[model samples]
Target chain A: MTTQQLTQQIRIKKSFLCIGLDVDLTKIPQHLLELEDPIFEFNKAIIDATHDLCISYKPNTAFYEAYGIKGWQSLQKTINYINEKYPEIFTIADAKRGDIGNTSTMYAKAFFQDLNFDSVTVAPYMGKDSVEPFLAFNDKHTIMLALTSNEGAFDFQTLQTNGTRGEAELSGAKELYKQVLETSKTWKNAQNLMYVVGATKAEYFTEIRKIVPDSFLLVPGVGAQGGSLSEVCKYGMNTNIGLLINSSRGIIYASNGTDFAEKAREEALKMQQEMQQILK
Target chain B: MTTQQLTQQIRIKKSFLCIGLDVDLTKIPQHLLELEDPIFEFNKAIIDATHDLCISYKPNTAFYEAYGIKGWQSLQKTINYINEKYPEIFTIADAKRGDIGNTSTMYAKAFFQDLNFDSVTVAPYMGKDSVEPFLAFNDKHTIMLALTSNEGAFDFQTLQTNGTRGEAELSGAKELYKQVLETSKTWKNAQNLMYVVGATKAEYFTEIRKIVPDSFLLVPGVGAQGGSLSEVCKYGMNTNIGLLINSSRGIIYASNGTDFAEKAREEALKMQQEMQQILK
Candidate 1:
């Protein structure tokens, strides 16, 4: 999925929300647990209820992985359902994957070819080879991690590097994250590459947008994590409405009652409505 | 697995090698493709044949994830088999995962809780929040990608950030990777934290080791990618012999014939021999 297509979807839907399917069996309605695959059962309802309200559906790999083989099967079923029923909606395998070259190529095949997700979130610390393999796939998008919203983010990401004076003098004064954004953009055009910027750090958006104006930002932590939608949209939105604000537990587990699906839709609608106002 | 335990196993086995289970259906022997689960069968055969020759088994998640539900199942069976049969051998879920806080917590659950891998590769681009969640698990190790062996690694990892004006400002002139290593170490003392430094980038090892002398490093891209094993060991090795050199295609897919497992064992033996010398 190119940045242009993602922007088109956002504009068409009048929404920039990506409903995260961090489906945990323990958190879902107790009734669904009776089914052979509770995770899939819960995901089916959530997707069916909120399909139209969202431009993208992010199935975090961890949630499915928790249940072992059964969990992985649920993940496959959910993605297959979305692909067959709502082909228009973009899908993201919120699997933060990256590795060496040949290994990464296999990973690219797993998410892009086997699972059929439009994009997969990737970690950039392994440098380029671990990530570029994901980018090599023409149609698939690779969302690199940028400024994240977490207390520990201050640990190393913001630290200063001690490079030789000769190399340091040329690149100008850029923070570590800024250099990552700038350098990652050079791997490919900003077309297939997007970035995961946490909603809590919306203040950094102004500076981030300046670095990669056209790239889509997959912003998580909005609903349940206490990140404000208004703040994220204010600084993060681009001309293409380049923002995928994700709400996982806030929407998926909004109501653990029998009307879980309905409650999910209500929660999604609430965010979508706010996003609609922001896009306008 | 801790560096001491890993080194102990390496010493006992007289090997510093880690056999990478990057099992691809196309690359495996044709006969295995006829089995109920081809990837798992291939991996099982390779493990059975080469368990005595190596100290660790690193399964690149991409190969498993590419096959969808079945692929993930194979991954589980392979890991479970290794953990149960060879409790001493370290297991690495070569799934480079890193994301925002909540999302990262889920990823940690996937690999650590559900899958039961000893370590997982993570990207440090999003700063602490994206990575700290993975480090929270006391038993499991979080292998952050420090410097990769791919062409794109040069893109962002080596890019020069702004430094002080006249004097070589160690405070200001930080490469993105240097910051990641330094900051990530402080997250959870160096105990559960490791870095993925490519074997190809041996030159940078002296500097990297200076900053992170105690942390373990999972070095990939050695045989098939042409990364020098000796150079990597010379500079990258820590006081604890903190290095796990991974060789995937060059070892696992060394042969496509019916004696694939035997061939894999032979290839593993060759690398293990070299690693044994390096450890000495």
Candidate 2:
């Protein structure tokens, strides 16, 4: 998926909502568990019902991984279902993976080549060599962790970055997330890079925009996390409207009854309507 | 396994060497490809040949993930084989994973409960909440990435973190890794924590030791990555002799021919001998 194609999809659908298919067995309808692959069956229903209302589907790898080999197979089936049916919709394998260079190359092959996700989320604590391998794949995207949407974000991402570079006379330390934004742009194939900036940090988006004006941002705090969609758009919307606002629990787990897929579709429609209004 | 048991094993064997099982198809003996599960067969042979030499087996998740379901099953088989045959040997899933609290809990279950790994590596980019879930598992351990051995470590870990609390007039930013160590100590269940300090940055150990005096560190980059074993022990060693020096390529891919397992055993034996001298 190219940058232009994603932008085109957002405009055509009049929505930039990226629904997170983070399915939990306990949370899904009780009837679905009788199936051989309950997770995939539940995801299939949800995707079939709400595919047109959203531009992307993000399957959080942790949820699938909790069940072991069966969980991995369900994940494979869910992704295959998406790609085969909705080829136009973008896909994200929300696996927060990063390692050393050679190992990272293997991961790139896993998601981008074999599993065939358009993008995968990566944690950037290991630095350039860990990330460059993912960026090297032009057709694929690497969504990096910049400022996460959790309370722990303040613990490290927002810390002031000072001292190590020398020059005390220089301006005060830049925040860690800001430092990440600036440093990562200079790396190899950074053009293929996008950042994960929580939508809850709408205030920070104004400043974040100053650093990464052109690159798309995958924002995850819009619905269940108490982030205002309007506020995020006010500060985050670029010329291409470079934002992929995500909603997981608020959309997928809308109800536990057999009408779960219908409820999910209703919730997605509400979000799509709001996005349509904003895109106007 | 508990920390005491691990330390005892190190002393009993007179070695703290950790052999990384990062299997790749192209690098393994070509004959194994004909087997029903080549990766598992290869890992089984390596484990059989060198089980007594090293204290721990660190299988990087990326290598297994690249092969998809087959790769994941191979990983399951390898871990099961190690636990069944050599129950006393410590196991490390060198998977650099971290996420929000709830999601991380699933990951903890995936690695510790389902797969039955003693420890799993996690990245600290998401802060305390992300790491706390992993720490919550009492019988298991969480090894956080600190100063990595790769060249990219300089990109962020070493940067000075300068930020202030409200009216606190906080001091200038400490190095990112130091901040991680200090902040992580204050979190709940921090006793289950270890850290990854790359052997390539052996000189940083003196400063690192002051921050984490008793915690065991999983150190990579001993042989293949140009790290000196003697230099790593000089500053990083604790009274408990807390260090697990890892060598992936140097041990596993020692030879591409049919003598691969023997060559791998020879390399691991060399590391074990060196570690014995250091322990003395």
Candidate 3:
């Protein structure tokens, strides 16, 4: 989906919420386990229950991959379902994948061509060539990791780097995440770039806005990770409302009873209502 | 496999040569396409032909992930074949995956537990918590990317960072990759940690050795990417011959004809002989 289409969906839904379909079979309702593909069944229910409450759905690949071949099949089914049922809604494959140039193309094909996700998250540690392959796909998006929500985010993302200067001249040092953002903009077809900046670091959003004001940011640390939606929206929202606040465990696992899907919708509804108020 | 076990295998084989199984369908012989599982068939042939010449097999996940379900099946079968048939050989899942703490555990489980790889490559951008989970597994190694063998590596990995000195200590600034190596050593299961230092950067290995002298370095770029074997061995090798030098396309795709497996063995044999001489 294009930026204009995503922006329109946010306005229509009155929520830039992206529900993370991080389905864990063990965590779902006990009754679902009896099904052939419990993961897909659970995701189908959640998507059906909460599709209207959010503009996007993100399925973190790790959750599916943990189950092996069965997991990959579930992922394929989930993506196919989303594309067929709600093609208007943006889909993000939260697969933090990156490699050398040629290998990265295969990954791009996997997520964008094969799986048909509108966007896929990518790690920036390998730099330009690693990310450029994903960006090369027209109309598809590459969400590069910036300041993540985890405790480990501070380990290297925030470290001060001398910004292409020699070792001796670290006078105007920028944090590594900022350097990543700045350097990435100069790559080929960088206009297709988006970013993954955790909602937990809402304060960083103001600074991040100065660097790439127009690019969309997929914020993950909102619900279970304890990031406040209001604070994130307050600082991160651009003219086009270029912020996708993601809530994974908080919404999906709201209740593990037979009414699991219904309860998930309730949680999603609360967030959407809050977003409606914020949009006003 | 434990580090000691891996070390012993290197000595026993007199070759730390790791063949990367990055199988692209188009690149493989057309005849294999007629088979039910061409990728698995191709990988089985390569593994059968070249097992004696190499100490380890590193199958990059991207090549498998591209083909969707069938690709994933191939990957599972290939790993199973290696573990059951060549139990002595170390296995590396070149899936450079990393995420937040809890999510990272799932990825660790995906590669280590579910897929049952002896070692898996992880990107270190997310820091300690993201990596420490992978380390939590017994007898499994977490190979973190230190310096990659690509043009993009220069874009971020080599940037001068003021060593955690509150952005003021510009005088003693170190490159980002070195800081990664230093920081990773302090994590919980430091003993289980290895590193990915590209063979293209042979000169950087001397500096890397100072920080991680004992830890194994899984060096790629030796064959297809134009990195030297002797230079990497000379500077990167430790007392335990701590290097798993990888050659993917250079060996596996040596010839796409019917004699592909035999040609691949010949190529691997040449590298193994070179490594054997280096051991002398």
Candidate 4:
């Protein structure tokens, strides 16, 4: 889907929420285990129950990959079901992939061509060539990691840069995350770029918006991760509402019982309602 | 495999050469396509012909994942063949995975427990929590990307840091890669850790060795990417010969004709011979 379609979906649904379908089997209802493809069944019910409540579904591939081929099949089924049932809904393969040139191209093929996700989260550690291949696909988005909402964000990200005056002059001796945002914009087909800026750092949004004011930001870490939606929107929102706030466990695993889907919708409704108010 | 077992293998084989099994169908022989599992057959042939020549096998997961579930199956088969038949060989799943704390644990289980890779490459962009879960797995290795061999390495890996006087004091206002090298050493199970220091940046290894001289380094970009093996060994080698220098396409796709496996063996033998001389 194009950015216009995604923007339209957000408007029509009155929500900018991206429900993360990062399902874990051990956490799901015990009864769902009896199904032939329990993961898919669980996801199917979740999408069925809550598809209208959100604009995007982000499946962190690690959850599906942990189960091996069976998990991949479930992921395939889940995405296929979503595309066929609701093509307007944007999809993200939260597979933080980045590799050398040719290798990165294969990954681009896997997520963009093979799986058909609207976007895939990519690590910027590998630089331009690692990312440019993904961006080469004009329609698919490449959400690069900026300020990750984790304790480790302080490790290398928050560290000030050691660039020479020539390098530092462009972006100042700012944090590494800011540098990633600045440098990425100059790459080929960068118009297709988005960013994964963890919502936990709501304050950083004010600074982030300055770097790429127009690009979409996929904000993870909403409910379970302790990011306030109001603060995120207060600083991060653009004229286009340039954010896709993601909620995973708090929404998908709202309940593990037979009524899990309904309960999930309840949780999603709460988010969608909050989002609608924010949009208004 | 433990570091001790890895050391034993390097010593036993008299070669620190690591063959990267980054197989792609287009690159492999057309004759192999007729087989039920051409990838596995190609890998099996390569392994059978060259197992004794190298100490480790690193199958980049992208090449498998690009083919979808069938590709994942081929990957499973490839790893199983090596583990069952050539138990001494260290296997590196060049999957470059890292996520949030909980999600990272799932990745650790996927690569270390489910897939049973002895080591898996991880991106350090997410910080400590994303990596510690992988480290928590006793005996398994987490090879973090320190300084990659690709052009993208220049983007972030080479950036000088804006460390405080205190941090700069510890590791100096070092480049991002050195900071990664220094910070990773402070993580739990640092002993089980390794770094992916690309051979193309062999000059950086001299600086890298100063941070953590003892930790093993998985150096890619050997042949196909124009990295000199001798230069990597000169600067990076430790008393334990602590470098798994990877040569993927140069060895694996040595030929696409009837003698593909033989040619692959020849390429492997050439590297092994060079490695043996270096060890001597």
| lDDT score at residue A20, model 1, on the 0-100 scale | 87
Candidate 2 has a DockQ of 0.75
Model 4 compared with the native: what TM-score?
Answer: 0.98
lDDT tens digits, residue span B1-280, model 4: 7777788888888989889999999999999999999999999999999999998999999999999999999999999999999988889999999999999999998998888999999999988999999999988999999989998888888887866532444445778888888898899988889999888877878888888899999998888788999999999999988899888899888899989999999999999999889999
| CAPRI category for model 3 | medium
List candidate 4 stretches off by more than 4 Å: A165-170, B165-171
* Decreasing DockQ order of the candidates: 3, 2, 4, 1
lDDT of 1 by residue, A1-280 (tens): 5667777888888888898888876788999888898888888899999988999999988777767778888888989999999998999998777766777788788889888999988876666676778888988899887766666555544444333233444355555566678767767534678898888877889999999998789998786677999998889887777788888888888899999999989999998889888877
- Total clashes for model 2: 6
Candidate 3 segments exceeding 4 Å error: A165-171, B165-172
lDDT of every model, 2 decimals: 0.80, 0.92, 0.92, 0.90
Compute each candidate's TM-score over C-alphas.
0.90, 0.98, 0.98, 0.98
Model 2 scores a TM of: 0.98
lDDT of 3 by residue, A1-280 (tens): 8999999999999999999999988799999999999999999999999999999999999999999999999999999999999888899999999999999999999999999999999999998999999999998999999889998898889888866543434326799999898888899999999999998888999999999999999999997888999999999999999999999999999999999999999999999999999998
Regarding DockQ, does 2 or 3 come out ahead? 3
Off by over 4 Å in 1: A1-12, A156-171, B160-173, B278-280
Clashing pairs in 3: none
> Comparing candidate 1 with candidate 3, which one achieves the higher TM-score?
3
lDDT of candidate 3 vs native?
0.92
Q: Please, what are the lDDT tens digits per residue for candidate 1 over residues B1-280?
A: 6667887887899877788888878888898878999988888889999999988899888778778788888888999999999999999987777666767787888888888898888777666777778878887888888888776676567755444322434455566677667666666545689888888788999999999888778888798777998999888887778888888888788789988889988999888888777777
Instruction: After the best TM-score superposition of candidate 2, give how far the Cα of residue B257 lies from its true spot, in angstroms.
Output: 1.6
State the lDDT of candidate 2 residue by residue for B47-136, as single tens digits.
Answer: 999989889999999999999999999999999999999999999999899999999999999999999999999999999999999999
Q: Is candidate 2 or candidate 4 better by DockQ?
A: 2
